[model samples]
Target: MIGILILAVLAGGCRGGSDSGDSRDSGHRPAGGMMDEGTAGQLPKDGKYDPVITLTYLRPWGPDVKFQEGEDQDNNGHTRWAKDKLGIQLKNLWISPSTNNAFETKLRLSLASDAEMPDIISYRGDFNLVRELIESGKFLDAGELFDQYASDTWKDAVEEDPTVWYPYMQDGKRIGIPILDYAYNSDPVMWIREDWMMKFGFQAPKTLSDLEIIMEAFTNQDPDGNGEKDTYGLTFGFKNWVNTWMSDAGWVFGAYGTMPNQWNLTEEGKLEYGSISPGAKQALEKLQSWMGKGYLAEMAGWYDEAKAVEEFTAGRAGIVVGPHWMPAWPLADVKQKVKGARIRAYPIPSGEDGRAGRHGTSIANGVILINKDMEHPEAFFTYQNYLFDHFANPEVGSEFENGLAGENEEAIADEGDQLTNNAVHTEGYDSEKYTVTFDGARIPSLNMATLLKLAYGGKAVTPFEKKVKSGASREMLEAAEIVMVQRNIAMNQMFTGPPTETMNMNNDILSRMEKDTFSQIIYGKISIDYFDTFVEKWKAAGGDQITREVNEWYRTVNEGQ
Candidate 1:
């Protein structure tokens, strides 16, 4: 399940969108935006289509997105730029708000009814839907089109992690172009209460035993100074899944060498279910011990990710694990509640072997498909190329950085001495999200690498770097440094393709059973040996067949590569 990632900064500002004087054509080839003479019917020189080209797509409108009084989805600043600057016209076939999965429902119905398909589709959720679209035979070979039309920058970005193409591959042809995003965006790091650490005279944990000692102190020592036994050592939610984006307990399993709820590669180079591994049993034993010592919250089994984080934010827990972005979010609430409260990010504690591992994030968040019957297929590439070249990482003091001519001065003035001049959206408008694809465009690893550079005393000379420096806090910089230092240990999920037949039939039942049994063992309602019985039952209930199917899919994809 890949959720759409909202970029921290708007990728494109209001620079070229409003200034391009080119006019739209009533026909396919308009007189305003044209190609060079004698190059007719061929790829254009500067991505300008010459005669205007119309690319149609369905719009998944966001509830939070606002439009200027005179502008709309069809006549916004971004759409104007496509018409005048790039000689492309974006046509929305229909509009559907994103709430309640409205867009996905419409698309599914379209597929089932064989409705007229748009020229291109930018989908950002559900790999299963992507697979269904590809299997429908309504889309073209995206790899072929990309190779033939994509700019060097676009090609290089996709090549950064070639595995991004795995999910969209069919019959040895890549049928979808992945929408790239920053890597390691959700990998876990340790966040500890600095005031509590100082009160307890503790240092950063270097090993699992060290972490345990800190947890015990936090649980029993009343680190909050309220003189009540209400605080816990560490906080995480395990009700939905052990491994998750927030309030994650994957590090706990990582401490023992496996991450539950994600497929991991074994020593023999075959994919295996992490929940059934020997390391998982060992991890369960350790969790049971922690439960006995009351080191974890008593409400863990009932808490989801949001509920679990409240344990830390309400100042009832001393530690929480999450991504580097925590300081900018719910974690910041602690400062307003606890006087003189200080929080800091640190590396995940090593296990007994002096090593650690945690769940890794994917670089590509969504898939973009092209309809086989569409005319002007290359126009999509041209529009995306322009976005990647300019807005992906805008140059300092450029029009993109300066924004609209009038608003530029005020936006720059707000930076103070930093001279951060990134463009600001017009009131009631965000031009980036109004483009053909959500969040406009991005280059994988660019944003994080820039943060890492600033984290270690590197200069912020570029606009992108300055933007990062202006937005990131000292704690976030330090967290980025810690994240990079532990990058090698990230255990990325290996089975990215759609679920297999056995998985479709038995996954829900197996997942419930696993969660129930694990929680029972941790709560002491069942003996640790019950794990052995659970594993045997899991195999009998289709876990073995699912493993075989996953490996077979893995082998086929790898062999295709």
Candidate 2:
């Protein structure tokens, strides 16, 4: 990481005249000292400022349009509305019209050129680029900026979990503001075809044995009534790390009280790598048996997430394990392919010892990096505060709802002056119709929960709460509700800090070793007895070193908190 940082800085500084005279000083300070009653720095009572400033941003998408047009900003509804209402113009430095790695190329050119940096950059992808930007020190420290300019609501959110700053932290300062997702992420659950289960006269599975029986039935019973055994029992893709554990068979290890790839604290207070645990071996044995018996998908290792879901939608597979949002995309396609296809989500099945657990990851994804030379670092917080308030109180006529009354109504108003609505519609309804409407002011990527609730028929005070309470026929909501009910049984990873020294050193070897071992065992190329050899190889390949470093990180994180 340090070497990478140095390279990025050298690359940035090599460009000439990129720095303007108004660029931020090496040291930052409050805009106008402490605000007093007479000071202009004080927030206006009317929530409006006379000398509004404009900031340019390089973002992933375009201004809001009736139909999306590549990565152009024309489809970005929120950016346009921000310019209109707040008197803040958010100009796009560039837009990429292609999806296949073209946007990343443009961003790379921007970084390598001598042009001045944009006031802000909202990245949707390319982790490597973000790392380079951080290494350059062109981005301001989000922690200090937040403290100086953030509104009360934004401050509270950042304080909710200090780990939110992990991704953007270089040395000790935070270079970016992370995008917050759920409080506890890693709650993967099994999504089963409800219609198939009923057709086969099987009950919802409660234990690992029960799951095996159900899967066997799905594979052999011809629940689709096609009178042929062409369908599979389960579906999953193992192409990426996200799909490997958090989305697919990762929960299988959870049932054995092992969360693979996570640094877990043992009863003895030692940090242990979950993947090399004895329990993980047990879970692998179970998976091996399932594969040999043809209960698992044959293309598990080859399929990406989309392809994996296709098997389910094509009615060739009966079960999939993923996050709560699975229904919104791949699973929802089942409705078009199979009439009366009903999928039901449930907690991961219990193991032989009655242990049921799911792994949890960090809530924040990446950081929002700001240009250090910006005139108003605090303005970013002010913008975020507005979004937060809207998230908290997403009423029909709220400012976030495109200035249209009852447009994104999650619920109807039964009475006046009430904080809640009686019924809610998903975000794109028009006059109780189910047509997909677009909101130029909507921030869907940042507030998916709110969008989902409006798509459903529930209402609450905030987007988070609404997602917790909202119930609709939508598959995603149903899956979320199921996971929410069993959150207590989930095991959140204790070590979510950046990859440690040993981890960085051995990451490639360990990942390949795990994948190969699991694949070989499942495919009957190696016996379950070989599990011990794999463990030994893991330790020899820096697993032991990783364990030590992970513990150290755990100690440091807890000590400071």
Candidate 3:
């Protein structure tokens, strides 16, 4: 229907919503999107679309998204909020379960079959798939459109880290609007069972050799005291690669002054493949030796993140490494598994030179791609700017400072009420703003930045940190404390060069080779010196060409930047 649509949205729990879409309150007034003849052909920055526009969108999450009593994904507070505020109603193009990679997997079928796709899609994971989508010639160039319609608020957000757009830019044309997330979410930390360390009378490790000593102790000291050798010193998944977001092994090389699966700048200012650095050779030899000494879990190579975390949850692994939030899920399960099990967080160990490196992703989460043929490119920007003002970065007295002023306004402020769980209010408000980048979201306030400031500042805890501490087991609190310290010293990779031409064509083959070779060297299937041969083979198989192109792109994107 072209008429306005408004749906009732209920509220949810008192805790901050999911990491994706949290921290939204409410606003007043139904706004406009399009303009009338008296105003010529133009859209209002803060009003509803004059001609109600329905956008076809793909929903990645199924019932995983909480909704109010009368609201579904397609007819919820979020949809109603958009319609009333921007006159942009979202039609559910299709819904796919995000779990187990189902969403992307199904979308790929459409992409390959030339099936009709949605007008707008917000995707995360498998960036290569995103690149494929762009090259499909189905998306619009968003640069000029953005420059013409982006609000000052949205502009400031992008300027915070402009490189976020570099990946979606093709041939100087910005084909995508980047979805941004917290910078520190991907930082690495070492998660060890503090009870085990205390039981063994071992202190936290400071250097690589100290880590080796602790690992040896964890393996042989019977820290679990079950009178059976059923535990491992360390556990992490290496099925995909040696590095990952969680359960990562990249820090091992970082301790030796390198990070595999990244490009590092040489003293000569040339881009050097991290895997070929001398530090990687030493780290691989160390891992091989550790494997021989029975310090590594036997299932490490075969495990994915879910499976890798099981050993730790099941109380068979003493150490796991990942980002600061590990205690929220897989580690949380550990408390249920072992009555006294205490997981604590620490910084990844450093080398003798006191340098450390960790695997990381770019600040951007995903991008918003629009259909090239869509006539309402400016419509998308108008909607996004509205979101930026009201939900993403609401100023106290702005038009959208309050959530959409519809039927639910009375219920939105009732935080104490337990009935409502509508998305306009309950939806992970934080993650979603970024989800619709083209229309538009922010770096949320969560990343523990405030908690860190309070913990180190010696001031009384704020309500948020107090909640972070409430009912938290002493061990969990201590882990959070340690994370506050780790945040300061962690190093993220600076180079995020776009995929080179050679990379786009040969990356699969090359990545497989490197994975196989690296795993072999660590597993003792290949000698340490084989890494040298693998390096040459990789360079010959297009690594060198990719390197040159990547350098050129880096130089270009960063010109005068």
Top candidate, metric TM-score:
1
lDDT of 3 at 447: 30
Each candidate's lDDT (Cα)? 0.77, 0.61, 0.65
Model 1 clashing residue pairs (backbone): 33-50, 34-50, 35-50
Each prediction's total of clashing residue pairs, residues at least 3 apart in sequence or on different chains, is: 3, 25, 31
Tens digits of lDDT, candidate 1, 1-561: 121111222232212222222211111231213333443564355546667778898757887678768977788777876787778889888888888999999999999999999998888876678888999999999898777666655666677678898788887789988888777888889999999999989988988899999999899998988899999888888888778889887887888788888899988999988898878888888888988899998888899998998888889998999999899788999898888789999899878987688999988888899999886676676677667656666655554563322123334333343434323324535666787777777766667777766676766665556656766789998998788778878999999876788998998899889999999988889998999999999999999999999999999878856
Please give, for residues 385-497, the per-residue lDDT of candidate 2 as tens digits. 55544433343434433222233334433323223222233343222111011111122122334333434454444433333344334666656556655666666667766
What does candidate 3's lDDT look like per residue over 14-97, in tens digits? 122222231122111222222336433334433556677777767467343554567566776567767776678877688777
Which runs in model 2 stand beyond 4 Å of their true positions? 1-52, 62-77, 112-115, 124-128, 184-186, 241-247, 395-397, 401-471, 474-478
Q: What TM-score would every model get versus the actual structure?
A: 0.86, 0.78, 0.82
| Ranked candidates, highest TM-score first | 1, 3, 2
lDDT of 3 at 531: 90
Off by over 4 Å in 3: 1-46, 66-71, 99-101, 393-440, 444-448, 457-495
lDDT leaderboard ranking: 1, 3, 2
TM-score of 3: 0.82
> What TM-score would candidate 2 get against the native?
0.78
Q: State the lDDT at 516 in candidate 1.
A: 95
